[model samples]
Target chain A: MDAKETVMNVLKDITGTDLSDKMDENLFETGLIDSMATVELLLNLQDELGIDVPISEFDRQEWDTPNKIINKVESM
Target chain B: MVNIQPYGTPEYFALIILFLLPIIIGLFNGRRFVNYETLFSLVFLVLTFGGSKWQQGVALIGYVIFEVITVGVYARYRAKQNNTAPFVWAVIIAIIPLVIVKVTPAIEGGKQSLIGFLGISYLTFKSVQMIMEMRDGSIKEFHPLAFIRFILFFPTISSGPIDRYRRFHKDYVQIPDKDRYLKMVDKAVFYIFQGFLYKFVLGYLFGKLLLPIVAHQAMLQRSAFFHTGLSLPLLGYMYTYSMYLFFDFAGYSLFAVAISYLMGIETPMNFNKPFASHNIKDFWNRWHMTLSFWFRDFIFMRFTFFIMKHRWIKNRIRVSQLAYLVNFLVMGFWHGVTWFYIVYGLFHAAAMIINDIWLRFKKKHKGIPHNRFTEGFAIFLTFNVICFSFLIFSGFLNTLWFK
Candidate 1:
């Protein structure tokens, strides 16, 4: 699967909610994900997309939305 | 020459408000009174660390200088290149003072470290956070003066809802528009008065008046039930200590955050109805939130990544469980090097592990009741567990067990 697809799948699996439509919404603010889920998403992204982002590098502004997370993953 | 500790009494608040008057007026007229802010910081620092505390004042100055140099050097090195060893050394060096401060009391039989000052831990957290963020390339610039302002931000210098460096810098450099500033002032007033109720009234009643009464009874009735397991007075001691700890710390946090607001920095909050939590994980998200978030981000996630990268922890569930244990253990040790504190940490670790297990099981068993009654029961259980843990954390366990 593509990076965007993988990100969506990870978000869905961890949050137990579908966020495919809310691509531009703030995941943290919307209560769709939290710190624990964020870690889980990072691990899943690393495993699936070969994108290794440290928790230290995780900023809410930089990757608060699905599209931003996808962009970050692809850039990495 | 008048010296007063931060938030130690009502008079301290009055003095701080008087000092903040000019800065507040300056902000209203669209000027930041930066010099006055710096002066207030120095004056408060003197109040906290001056007079009988002059030795601590010296230590704070020396510690600040050392951290500034260390962080400045680390940031320069990181800007040029990314290396693991130097980053590790920088973090170790930054934390060395705190480690010494924490350890000295244990080794010296409770004689406080001479080099220790109030809020050293909070300051160290700020500095070390900068170093870590710098290494990650998130904090690209390291201005020395800005760094000093961030560390010595006096409102939270003593106890913190430990604010983020970048977030604080953003607020510090900008003067909020009048409407926004007015709203902040309103909230600040509410928080300060609410803090008065929490700290002075409820905290005094619970901690000073009731805690001693119950604690004394617990000691007198120490041999009432099986001579070490459980007694009525011990149970009373647990509830009283739990309430005292919450009101005292939460009240202090309100005062800190409220003062930060008055200064135009939105310091993060430390509590959010923690007793209403239905589980250990939820409880952490509510109680001493900044400290817990710090541990989660810095310690737990990092350890999980380290173990995974090395393939040391192949099972994901086991990896998290182990990480939780390590995280709480360090937090426990940070509180003190005592057996009770260590046990308190272990208790939470174990509780969280069980909580995670239950959550997973409940997820599978969808037919299990998930309603208000069950939720209330869960909250009640979590509350008692937390109270028992605070009893352990209160150091009363040491008196009960060893003394």
Candidate 2:
């Protein structure tokens, strides 16, 4: 699977809600994930894909969407 | 020497406006008089800390120097290395003064710590945040002067809408254009007026006037409801004190933000219709937002990550529950090392855990109704729960039961 699929799967595992179709939607605003889930997502990303997003650098606005998270992970 | 508490009196507001006039004009003309602003902040700081509060002034200076050294050394150390021990030590050393200030009163039979000054907690929050961000490599440089300015920015110095270093630095460096500055001024005026209504008018009504009567009545009923002090007057006191707490603090916060805006810094707000919250979690997001968000980010998120990263807790639900307990317990201790405060923290932690369980259950059960009526009921339930929590927080129960 690609990086996007992996991220989506991780997010689904954490939030118990699929976001494959709503890639650009804000996870926080939509209540799909919160700070707890965000931390979990970061950890899962590290374990699964080795993308270590520091909690300090995790701006909710910048990484609010699934696509944004995928892009940020890719860039990193 | 004249001493002035920031936004303490109507005269303070008048004096601030008169002094801020020059900065306002400078901003209006697309210029930021940084030196003048700095001088203004120093003068206000001196006014606040000088005179009868000279001891606090001395303590504040010593405290600031200590923190600057600790954070500065940590920042320097973090530049080339990434050791968890040093980072933990940095956080501990930075909070040492605040911890002393908090614990001294508890240990010394309510004698205030000499090292404790007004806004010590707020200052420590900012300092610790800087250290944490530096550890994360988010803050690459630590300028002592800039850090001092951020710590003692005077407007929100005493109590904060706890502005972040990066956010404050951005606004401080960039002078808002005339249009944006003008809009800011408009908002500032509105906020200041709203502060007057909340603080002088409504807060005065609830806090100064009604609170005393209700408190006295509640005290008189110390033997009521099976000596549990659970009287109607106590209930009255709860709702009344809740309003007083909200208005008084929210008013002060509005004044802080309004003044920050006049100085061209967009300080984050502290309140957002907190009573309308539908759950404990939502209430936290709305009420004392900066402080709660600070706790959420630094304590809750950090603790959760630490636990998970260490694989100490396999169950995510239990991990979050533990995080909430620590977060609220620390918050309670920060309020003071009192039984009521600690119980208040535990109460909120319980509320949050229960709220989380309900939220999860709701998510699973599609049969659960979630319409306007249900939403309103949820809000009403949350409001009462919060008010009851505030009563526990007020320490009146201590007076009724122990005193």
lDDT of 1 by residue, B208-280 (tens): 9998998888888777667773678889989988888999999999999999888888999999999999888
For model 2, residues B1-403, the per-residue Cα lDDT tens digits are 8888888889999999999999999989988998998888888889999999999999999999999999999989998899999999999999999999999988899999999899999999999999999988899999999999999888998999898999999999899998899999999999999999999889999999999999999999999988999999999999999999999999999999999999899999999999999888889989999999999889999999999999999999999999999999999999999999999999999999999999899899989987999999999999999999999999998998999
Best by lDDT: 2
Candidate 2 lDDT at B169 equals: 96
For candidate 1, the C-alpha RMSD (Å) to the true structure equals 2.4
Q: Cα lDDT for residue B254, model 1? A: 95
Q: Model 1: how far is A54 from its true place, Å?
A: 3.7
Q: Where does model 2 exceed 4 Å of error?
A: none
Evaluated against the true structure, the overall lDDT of model 2 is: 0.93
lDDT of 2 at B181: 93
Pairs of residues clashing in candidate 1 = none
* B387: Cα error in model 2, Å: 0.3
Model 1 segments more than 4 A misplaced: A12-37, A46-52, A60-76
